[model samples]
Target: SVSSRSRISLIASTVTIAGAGALLAPAQSKK
Candidate 1:
């Protein structure tokens, strides 16, 4: 069974990816 810790890890990974994408957008537009 999955633990609450595992759920939090998944959410953290998702947020990291989303943050990276958000950061990348402006850099791309500047080029």
Candidate 2:
């Protein structure tokens, strides 16, 4: 259970970072 929770948290953080990067990428490219 503990391992699964950690795995989920790690995936969540990775997805969040990827999402933020994706959002910023287009804006930066436009600039």
Candidate 3:
């Protein structure tokens, strides 16, 4: 179950980072 849980968390973090990156893009472009 270690590998499975790690994979799930990895995916979740990836999604979160992607979403944050998306949100920051517009602000970055304005700079």
Model 1 is weakest, by summed lDDT over 10 consecutive residues, at 1-10
Cα lDDT, all candidates: 0.96, 1.00, 1.00
Model 1 lDDT per residue over 1-31, tens place: 4788899999999999999999999999999
User: What is the C-alpha lDDT profile of model 2 across 1-31, one tens digit per residue?
Assistant: 9999999999999999999999999999999
The collision pairs in model 2 are: none
lDDT of 3 by residue, 1-31 (tens): 9999999999999999999999999999999
> Per-prediction TM-score, please?
0.73, 0.88, 0.85
**Quick one: best TM-score, which candidate?**
2
Q: How far is candidate 3 from the true structure (C-alpha RMSD, Å)?
A: 0.6
